[model samples]
Target: MKVAVHPDRRPSHEAEVIAFSYHRLALDLARHLGRDVNNWYCYAVWASKAVSENLDLSPGSCFLGDVAARLNVPVWLRRPFRRVFLALLGPSYPLALALANRAIFLEMGSLAAELWDADDDYLIRVDETGDFVRRPEFLSALLAPAEEEFLDAVVRLFTKARNATGPERAEFVLGANIALVAYEQQRAQRLLELVLNRPPRWLLQGSWRWLWCALRRRPFHRLAIYTAPHAELAWPARKAERWWVRFYTSRLMVMRTPVGRIQLGRPLPPPKGAAPETVWAPIQDLEVRELVDRFLPSDFDRATAGVGNWLSFDDRMRFIVAYFRMYANVPELFDPPFTSDKLDELEAEMDEGHVPEPYQEWLQKENARRAAAGRGVRGLIARQRYRSPFRSDPDAAALAGFDLTGCVHRRTLRPEAGPEALLCCGIDGELCGDAGGRCGRQA
Candidate 1:
């Protein structure tokens, strides 16, 4: 018999319906809310699900989630696994596991009571029953366990979040956004305030905070960017935004210039709504208290600890898997990349022919170019040639286009793919979101 079921009840993987709680759902939301390594690996797996592209998906992806659980990350992460030299990075394992734990929710599913809709008091028409029933009663039956039991868990989760205070509430805070609940208007506004750090009316040095808001696609809202990762971000989840992500195109001009400094399309700020406050989303894979005790940075006041042009990770092979520090909020996992030795040490290595051939050649020409330019002569390379409004680093789409207009779309991270608006179209039809998992499966 056919019955209306929410998309949340029918996960792409059947097991997901059973394992999913606010935890896994929050991780899913995080991917949609911001850009991370999961986007890259998930795209490859989804594009070739038939071909069985070698990549990770279930149980969580790298960095922001449970990448530590499976040390053998997908090839994309492996490609970036390097011995970056920086003192700021200490140990990656503790923090990697911390992020992984943050993605697990064994006890938070009870908040399902918030699923009740008092506004319209929906009625469900089950084909088998041939009768009308309260929407809450019908939908609650879709849960894996007793409706009341799940409601208890959900209530506890939401109450904890509503009652919590300070930065310690970040994990539950992220979970609140994704947890199945029907929040009152007042409660919703409060939740938004808890997650978002609204910059005061007063401005800052050089208007960096203002630019953060303007570029994030939310010109009206005056908010800041997350100083760290995963939370305090106001990413676009509108229908138009999703469509653009799936169909947005750009110009290809990689070959126009042989070599020179080229603009990378203004270097978008975290690719979404991010703020300056650093909040650590809790993880459950490891000892929650232990993870925070040992790995949490003692100082969050590093001068250069602010957002970087690109996120950096500390990669190392340890224990049963390779530990990585990719969470911008937790620099403790990064590698220590400073040395007090004399300047001649690095110069001596370069002089000893240790530099790669391409860089060595570039160096010789660069010095000659600088000298020639000083003398008012032509340099080895010409001016920078740029194309595309977002990025021009030769992505998968741009390479395939091989045309003047190298069109591209977001391979993953679509809004419908996350916790989003419900279609709620027909009374007799299934209570579906537009997704139906078709677009998600395609991505």
Candidate 2:
């Protein structure tokens, strides 16, 4: 019943008690599935990536959420299966919840992004006419008597968390379903510092989305969305930035997302009499997000050294090809083969040119030998590839959303805005992602 009693350093009375759906399944899998199932830190597992609109605190629910197939989804069989697991693993639920930390990193945004869409906003909206009502206004109308009071409470929560020790910081954060954090080198402190500073209209909607979309401006392109202190800053155009702030709905749970002197998503502020470009320059450094970038932030947030992956996954053949080869180069892997997006990376120095005559002859002989039998094609059919702990990220496309109109939020906002700098948003819980007069360019 009592799975993880907070760390011994902290008193148990102050800790939270909650439940997870498949706590037992996760625990059993971790214990029995593979002795080598990756070990991910609880902190990294708790962190989030973009697609902020719908985050819920459930077991194994990170950016790389549940990928294991659900074989039993029929209405009649669902309840019984759950009950059986519940009865089997009932007593050790806490152990499962406590150890259910690591999740695989698979995507940049929602994998079921289209399916995840639901009309949950009761306070804000952009009707067909193109006008918008932001969250603050909506919350203000609904929580009228308590809206201002809740805002004050949030400010106080931030203050309390700011003053707490590193271990206790999460206590203040989750109390309000907040993921308050800092930008690089303690640039901004807490999501509220910038969020509250801006008008609600701008807090929920910004002008950057439009600038990125309309003129193809680079807006906050390759910043680190998760905390990756261990990731090496080796990739090109990939500056080391460990700062983020995301707003989401967590059911009866608060995330341990806050750390000290950090700001979530808001850009840094220009100091008194300092050059304004210092702050603005970072925001404008838009570069493309690549597949290698996907491999950087892991669900474990570990160092990048040990995670060496040389061979490419021939999605077509469903096999591990030579480190240098790709589907285009491998002629033998044709005729209804498969490829994996796992190693969908772009190589710097390609593996081209001709194979040496001796090696080529050996490959032909091997192909002939395998072809005479009924095994398969070129590459080795990978039975057990490494299960590296990775953080789920949005696709390169989602990270590059503003430029291409990232989500329903941005896609809906574009046509509503004027051709010039002024921007607008038409989706509910969505704001005009435009720079509006800031860029001075209209549609």
Q: Pick the candidate with the highest TM-score.
A: 1
Which tens-of-lDDT digit does each residue in 3-39 have in candidate 2? 1112211111111111111221223322422212111
- Model 2 ranges off by over 4 Å: 1-160, 164-171, 175-177, 180-427, 434-443
**What number of backbone clashes does candidate 1 have, counting pairs of residues 3 or more apart or in separate chains?**
25
Best by lDDT: 1
Q: For residues 85-152, what per-residue lDDT tens digits would candidate 1 score against the true structure?
A: 11111111111211111111112221121223333212111111222222122211111111111122
State every prediction's TM-score relative to the real structure.
0.18, 0.16
Model 1 segments more than 4 A misplaced: 1-12, 16-160, 163-295, 299-443
Candidate 1 positional error at 60, Å:
20
Candidate lDDT (C-alpha), each: 0.22, 0.21
